[model samples]
Target: MMSALEADFGQTPSQTVGPYFAYGLTASQYGYDFDQPFDAVLALENARGERIRVEGRVIDGDGNVIGDALVEISQPDGEGRYPQTVDEARSSGFRGFGRCGTGTESGNRFVFHTVKPGAETSGEAPHINVIVTMRGLLLHTFTRIYFSDEAGANANDAVLQSVPADRRGTLIAERVAQDGAVRYRFDIRMQGDGETVFFDV
Candidate 1:
């Protein structure tokens, strides 16, 4: 579904939405052939001591696969509250969200890379959340995992409910899965498709 914002500016690149927002303005639903997605590549692994890993992959509107896309995943710190820090990161402009590095320890646990997510609406069963265990600077643990996301399923997600407002964009991710090596090139904020916006209730 093309967002109401994308419909406003017929055919031109934009950096500003209605008035104040100036990021992800030129966002378009998968117009034309979604077969050709922008370059994107990323992955995620659990920090839990189980064989759990969320193999995220990127997919086009037509269900095609996008490769070579770069993705950066971040969440709130322990207590699921990293509002101050994230604002600091985002304050540095694109540099904050653009810096590609390994995952960090937050929210009383660890979070790392996972594959991009498929175009599954929020109403499907628990997909794979590859759960892994990281100890020290070495491969201290490993395992697979299964997590859940339900646009039509649950009104509230545990991990998702831990974030604060305004800074809730931290929960967004274009993570998905596909056949071969895929990538994620979707821009997400605190609303609509592509952007995995969650609540703090």
Candidate 2:
């Protein structure tokens, strides 16, 4: 027989991220209502930047939309400087972050009103760091949204360079013009063919 200390300590199986995340992680559900939609704006009053819209759908392996997915994004200000604190962010009018849920009726679409992020650090292209969470996800998925317009900068970005050439396009957002507004579409595919290029971090 194995000694008490020598006996194996079985590990617990991992659990999925949600079904409850919508009620728990959201601002309105958390009792902090801003009286506006979740994707309203990242920068406030005095924030300096060219306002733009980023919208996309979250699709699953089978090409079905995942309506309940929650998306969170972080990006630097137009000048490429990130706000260091809450107070600084509010005072400077630069939120530098935003979150939104993919409503079921809207075909799992999510949108964000924000400025185009600039290159803060050298060798890093202007990109938004994205995190996605949903009911069946064991952990949040991470990826970067690169601008299709920045071909030159993107060509030199270390992270972009690391991705295989054929798959690199999965990370770039397509620029579009609609209703006199500029928008970028960046769909996230959870699995199967054409899966978005996710990072290890």
**How does each model score on lDDT?**
0.27, 0.82
What is the per-residue lDDT of model 2 for residues 1-201, given as tens digits with 9 covering 90 to 100? 899889887532332354356434565633555443444369775887777899898888998887667888999988898999889988988888888877642565888888889998998899999998886777888999999999999999999999999999999999998998889999999888999998889
Question: Tens-digit lDDT track for model 1 on 8-108?
Answer: 76423222111111112112211333332211112113211222122243332344332322233332221222225534434422111111211211212
Best by lDDT: 2
**What's the lDDT for candidate 2?**
0.82
Instruction: Name the TM-score of candidate 1.
Output: 0.24
Q: What is the lDDT of residue 1 in candidate 1?
A: 89
At residue 94, candidate 1 shows an lDDT of 16
